[model samples]
Target: MHRNQGLYNYLNEHSWQITEDWYKLVNDEDSESIYSTTDPEIIQSLKEQNQDYFQHLHKLFIEKEEDFFRDFKIWSEELAKDQKHLKTPVQYVVREFMNSQEVYMKYLKEYFSLNKDNVALDQFLSWIDLVRRVVNLSIYIYIEEANRNTLRQLIAQKEIINELSSPVILLRKKIALLPLIGDIDTARAKIILENTLSQCADLRIEDLCIDLSGVAIIDTMVAHEIFHLIQALKLIGVRSTLCGIRPEIAQTAIQLGLDFSHIRTTATLSQALDRIIAD
Candidate 1:
């Protein structure tokens, strides 16, 4: 038998034992909550994943001269997307990979101690190098997937926030209330303007009560944007009523020489509703 084949047979025979040892090592050092599960099914699933990884790794060792293992690469990508792995802290995943390498190296050392005459030093070194390359590839794929998942979550959160910030509540037929709250930066103001116009057109809102009681300040540019938003609503056949303008915002608007003569103003949302009801 070839020297490489002998090594492969040894690894294949002891694969289960190595997997159990690796699991024990990871379970004992479970600080990141990745493998510290009480559920039997979860524990079994983790063992299965580890076993699959080792099996793929063993195939690579048997064919060390190959440029890449397409099957293993595909499996690694799928493993990266696994919900359990995705939820696991990345540092824990990295440490687990390190732990597996250490286990395999220790097993190889033990195997060669008794059969040192059977394996060449160069072949042993090559196997160690192959293990290192596979671990590195797995780490790279895991990190890339984690980053992509994080970015997706951030985008989802932003969309939810935008929807919440510019909510158009329909209080009556042909009437809606848009209560502006918190700080309105340029980006948020733009979102508010676009969402408001789209909602008004969809709801066929004839009168929109825009309350600014929650808003504390508005610079000239923001004030202009608000004015432009109102003008845009008018063009879309929606009459926008400005309400709850704070003293500071109104003063800024005056300083900018913005004419609010054509725009209807209300002191409160209830009063705006009352006027709409009375009219």
Candidate 2:
């Protein structure tokens, strides 16, 4: 029989004992591990996952076939995306994999000692290489999946922040209030312009009161974007009224040679509201 086949058969026959001993070692060393928790369901689930991993690992060793490795890769990818695994820290997962590697190596060493007449040095070296390859691939998949999950979360958060920063609250049937607060940068100005125009169209807002009372500073680019937003609103048949234009902002707009004669201005949101009511 082939050396790999002999090793595979030995491991497959003792898979149950290996898994049990591996879990015991991990639990004994890692008391705070999610797998070592007292919850029966969680513990059972972790056992099942470990068993699945071992089954695929055994197949990979026995077959040494491309399809077996492909299936193992797919299974490892799924495990990486698993909610339970994702919740665990990457360090903990990595440590667990390292422990499993140690356990497998110890078991193989024992197996070699018992079957010294049958197991050759080259065969032992081949088995070690296989173990290293599997462990390295598993770690790579885990880290890649974790990075993807983090990136997905960051994108979701950015979308939410963009929406919150450019809110349009409807005060009346045809009037909406867009309160602009904080410093206006070019990027934020673009988001503000796009979201406000889209919301105004969706809400059928004829008059939009843009309150800038909380805004502290504005640059030339930001002032130009504001004017562009007003022009865009006009094209879509929504009249924009600028409210609470602080002295600094007004001075900056003037310094930039921006013409605001076509845009309506108010001292406060209340005055803008009064004008809307009178109209």
Question: Looking at model 1, which ten-residue stretch has the lowest summed lDDT?
Answer: 60-69
Which residue pairs overlap in candidate 2's backbone? none
lDDT of 2 at 34: 74
Q: After aligning candidate 2 to the native by TM-score, how far in Å is the CA of 43 from where it should be?
A: 0.5
TM-score of each: 0.88, 0.87
- Residue 171: error of model 2 in Å? 1.3
**Model 1 clash number:** 0
lDDT of 2 by residue, 1-279 (tens): 223677778888888777777777764335545765777887777777776787778776567456766888988998899877776778888887887888788878888888889888777777777877888899999999988988998999977987898899999898999998887777788889999999999999999999887888777776788888989999999988999988887888788787778889998999998987888
User: For residues 3-76, could you state the per-residue lDDT of candidate 1 as single tens digits?
Assistant: 37667777889898888999888653465466888779988888888988888787765563453456667789
The segments of candidate 1 whose C-alpha lies over 4 angstroms from its true place after superposition are 1-3, 28-32, 64-66, 69-71, 255-261
lDDT of each: 0.83, 0.82
Q: lDDT score, residue 240, model 2?
A: 87
List candidate 2 stretches off by more than 4 Å: 1-3, 27-33, 65-67, 183-190, 254-258
